[model samples]
Target chain A: MGSIHLPSHEARLACRQNRLTNTAGVAPGYLQANLLILPAQHAADFHDLCLRNPVSCPLVGKTTTPGDAHAVQPAGCIQFPDFDIRTDFPQYRIYQNGEYLESRRDLLDVWTSGHVAFLIGCSFSFEDALTTAGLQPRHQQTGTIVAMYRSNIPLLPAGIFTGGHCIVSMRPYRPEQIDRVREVTRTYLSTHGEPVAWGWEGAKQLGITEINNPDFGEPQVFEEGEVPVFWACGVTPQMAVEAAGDRIKGLVFAHEPGHMLVTDWTSNDLDKLRPGII
Target chain B: MGSIHLPSHEARLACRQNRLTNTAGVAPGYLQANLLILPAQHAADFHDLCLRNPVSCPLVGKTTTPGDAHAVQPAGCIQFPDFDIRTDFPQYRIYQNGEYLESRRDLLDVWTSGHVAFLIGCSFSFEDALTTAGLQPRHQQTGTIVAMYRSNIPLLPAGIFTGGHCIVSMRPYRPEQIDRVREVTRTYLSTHGEPVAWGWEGAKQLGITEINNPDFGEPQVFEEGEVPVFWACGVTPQMAVEAAGDRIKGLVFAHEPGHMLVTDWTSNDLDKLRPGII
Candidate 1:
């Protein structure tokens, strides 16, 4: 638990040694990324999917080339140094032909040159921004993981990756604070960005009928006059992989829910790295 | 030449009918893109290259899926409607096993389901911004094409795409107007944003020796107290294709240098569509 206060590199070192189980609060201001590793053959389609659905899956880093795991390529710059995709995450979930296999502390036994690692932006990166704006997330206040749900919003399908829904993470905010929340979170582009929907009506519009029952993470208690604000979740790519099923010919690996890769970049770095205007 | 003032769809229609030869000033305020078409096998690596080198290749649109030409996928939204990759561009240059083949008005004779089309951001998109700021490009004032050069800066390699240099386009501006020039152009993210290098020293840093002569497009004269400004060019991917030589398995097609794909989207639409903080 004390490792949460460490810098990104030290936290990653802690993760490598199995000293940490979850990275929810680790390295407070650094960028935390969702992990997804796939076979080289399926890499292109998944890349195209990320390009098409950036809000759901904003790419932060990836292996320089297929099978090379040491350096990561973030937007605009060539190298994110001192990182190993295989051992940097606290834990990894293994899936084969769309079915869950098991969890591992590291991918030492399974990773190969045929694999390509991708790092997607995580909602955790924007949590600090919310707190800084004095709008603490209800789940964080209750000391639990943020609530995530599968929405009725269908993603634009790419290649054999089809029939996937946009998974969203929710946080409770008062009606008055919603605008400020949007103003704060929207700047964290590499993260999930602005809320996709807000209020109870927003939830209904997304077809999320089970408000209190989340597919992942613990449910939060809504205060009086509070509305549920939803954002595109990083879990989307995992669901996309599952929907593709046996069409995916090889093994898939992702960060265990609540456990992520703490990156060398920060939110400010991402803002600067965004394309076009700075 | 009258088609330059037409709407994007009508301009594309004019291009398809061979009524247009260049797209430099077509459909003012709309986005114009550089075209790169590759066989399905080499598309992935080239996509990876674009990701690694965004300044030289800011992707604005691409085919929905491999072999699909009717729709284009920009950043956030799923589709840019009514686009035909094969015929929308005024002209295309054909290459075989990396060697220069021929130029064609349309790819109808060589079209196959095995090809993928990518639309990269062109410097022409920023010319409108420059003009609006009262910093008209010297090339445009002289009624000539922007001067393009092969710089010594190398691109980050991706798979089979290697040994490629960053190609650049040059425009001259008065020394006093340089700061305003950057402030205006930097906001056009979908277009090549901001000058990568400026002044004679900047050109020297890029390893361009002959300032008066360029590899492509006509040369422009620098006035007294004016300096050369360089931005990452859309021709980079083409030069990369030439560098890779026969490693590319099948046919490759790119817009004839100055002829581009006029898109339905505008600069304002791109600003709103940019990921994060919009």
Candidate 2:
């Protein structure tokens, strides 16, 4: 607890200086975001893609102008005063013409003047909230990545970003705990609020044929009386980008799945944005 | 409530037979929808547009196949066994190359084999819920149309659906009633749920300079001690379609403002779709 509880600025500085190579369970209480950078030509479609598929993509903030690395200012984020999108993440996944190329420590060398960056809320931000509420996420207990699967549920298509199933992450909890879990997650709207599906039968409706095998993260078994709860995963944007299939210009960039950009916003800051209240 | 309390099937039948010339205050218990029909080529982009701008365009249902009017079957909507999209609405506005041409009683004359239809949830469905909860809509009280404005809040772009401000409906409520109104409205997810802004100051931040001169709908005076409450309106989809400009193929059809497609669903059915409950 002592080492993991770093201020948001120090955590981001660690990533910037390459002192922290991965963000898993680091900087508790701060909100972490999935990063996606695309050429300006696809910016509109990608923005629409996030809006259309909000449960999966939940856009936290986006650059105010294309190629301006420090354009987005997270609501109430007042730390560092100098945030650069190009070199602020622990690691980045580079894609060329919609195909995955390689992972890089920073985008300083590859970023184009035409690139637009989008910061999407990550589920990691709410895990702390769940813990605070006394519900432990199974992945944290097992010290493994959360299990993810490609569901049959089709994403509403947007322009060149067309024809892909929604990607979801899964956790198992007793039926009695489902309501409480949902209530906790509901507050984190920017970070994919609430489970889209619950119970063993629910996954079949989403078109995932196998429970034990997952497309991303490690698979887990359900305990007795436990049901599988599913949520729209941040990986969905990556899948949407891949689905673009050669329609993309030269390059697109994203954080390696589970690796993220830790922002100055606290999990509590996101919870304050509860819908219907404002 | 004698004439307005007709069941869903009876209400739709009245419209189909041209017996009931208008839908407002008719079919009080049933859900009504804003209809939009477009060429099959623009179907994917349109779907994305709805997904991207869900608050403004809550997609209740869409055709399962291109040109198939009977494709969508809302879960538990068993009232209307002989529904047809072509003649079920009281009136429709036709747009060619994104220009408003004329309003017609039915789409039968303009129907094409290359068309797809979307049924967007309307705030009209939630009015009954508000009434049931003892909060009367001001428009109903004034016997006028709901006030709508084009706010500066930019919509997430999708394909040809680019650069349009969100069009919101305004209803004034006493400051004490705002919470009750929000609570009742929050239950209707298929319909636009909850007010985006409350009070005069909130409207200005949304980029609405003149609340009195709305781009659509009739304006009303705020009662003493009443605050301006703004909710995302269905007119948003129309603005997005218009923003597409010449990109739209040949023709697009939508219900005239205040005219809608009465469906077999009840207001309770929509309220039951409460987010995070699943």
Candidate 3:
């Protein structure tokens, strides 16, 4: 039962039935998304935050209207025909007043009609493109989640979502390969396009003090002459929620870090789904 | 006085003093923006509407925080150092509870700390590019404002901003010129990038029944083999506010059509200022 080759629908069904726990490599060609559900009252501000900080929080799709669990395409087609927002993700992390509560297998008991669900594009989609281009990420070779850090890069604040910094994921690449790496990643605009910074000086500029001790995910070992390249991480919205302190009232739900929602869209759909192309 | 060759700073000064009213050809190389100011309570929802419909409401610069009037860059630099949002636009249209009130020379009496200002990218930036590429819009040749019409294209609703259709500006071009037209406009991403529809059949698909009788701007007289080419218009947000029908409360301010905010950024700055490039 290797899940990496499963189609998107079957992979999502496995998560719903509690058969799959980690979604990193599952549904290889399909896009994976980070989930963030908030009360309808707070949906606008969070949506604004994502739009303002698109590098870190590239929005892919969301419920057609507040409280609708089904994510739909702009043309009104349901992106995942049989998808259930509450049960499709392998794990859900619940937070209240900006403090973590606990992780749940599903949101059956927690989901309310008042909640608005947002699906953010994840880096996995671009990683697939990179691998196809023969630039396998270091974390993939090491069998670990990509290293993540909180950078000093400030997010453009929106209403209650204030006082937050960007969260970034790191991958080691040879200095000479940097140009090609950027060219490959920049095409996946909705999934954190291009590297924000690179090299030791770049990390220090972002105020990252300990390169080995990441704020999230496993640490990676860098080889000689290989500089670190940082991409805006999907975990940024989570940090924004945490930084909001008591300003975020009620409950907020997000997919547990590495366990993402496998979407029906593929890397091939990227160009057509761009913001203004339609 | 001639303003097409004026520097951005000086052009903004002229606008502030009412010395320049129509910004169509002013500050030739600089970017111009459509203005939308709402009470803080509606800011998030309107912001969401803009994000959901980037082709029509491409947001470029916005106030640093709610209730602040000065628009700033991502790095905290004031986009126009000596600019004042309330008086900088040549004219302002006032709205209350989704109904048009009256036009004003300035918002000195209406502006308050509870208002949030947003600057949406206008098609003028791309029109400049099209002209530079020898694809001058028909309106420029005819010496009239571009023709605009309300299309049946449904907008992605957010919160209280619902039931709105897309508004588009039209320019007639020969069938063969569209490819070059799209290439020229697509690079100006923040401005309404590329034509959403073209030709008679394309316009019909958008449910635009009255091509010769535009809802706004003077109707264009098409020549032989010339077809209507439509691009998303900045006026869509205004229509959304109108369609909200009392869902919008307090006061709303927008630039009178064709009177926009000229900023310090130039066409060359576009690629660097794109989302996530920072």
Q: What DockQ class does candidate 2 belong to?
A: incorrect
Q: Rate the local accuracy (lDDT) of all candidates.
A: 0.78, 0.74, 0.76
lDDT of 2 by residue, B1-278 (tens): 22554577777878888786546566787788888899999987677566545767777776667777766645333333456788888778899877889988888888888888887878888787788888778787777778888876555555566556678888888989977887777656567766766777767756777877878778877878987888777877778878887899879998877777787677657644322211
Which scores higher on lDDT, 1 or 2? 1
- Model 2 agreement with the true structure over A134-223: per-residue lDDT tens digits: 887888777777888997655545556765667888988989998788778765677876677778777776678788999977888677
Number of the top-ranking candidate, with DockQ as the measure: 2
Task: Compute DockQ for each candidate against the true complex.
Answer: 0.02, 0.07, 0.02
| CA-only RMSD, every prediction | 21.4, 19.2, 21.0
lDDT of 1 at A78: 35
Interface RMSD of 2: 13.5
Instruction: Return whichever of 1 and 2 wins on DockQ.
Output: 2
| TM-scores for every candidate against the unseen true structure | 0.54, 0.53, 0.54
Clashes of each: 1, 3, 0
Q: Which regions of candidate 1 fall more than 4 Å away from where they truly are?
A: A1-278, B1-6, B272-278
Q: Over the stretch A97-127, how does candidate 1's per-residue lDDT look in tens digits? A: 8878999999988998899988888988878
- Cα deviation of A223 in candidate 1 (Å)? 63
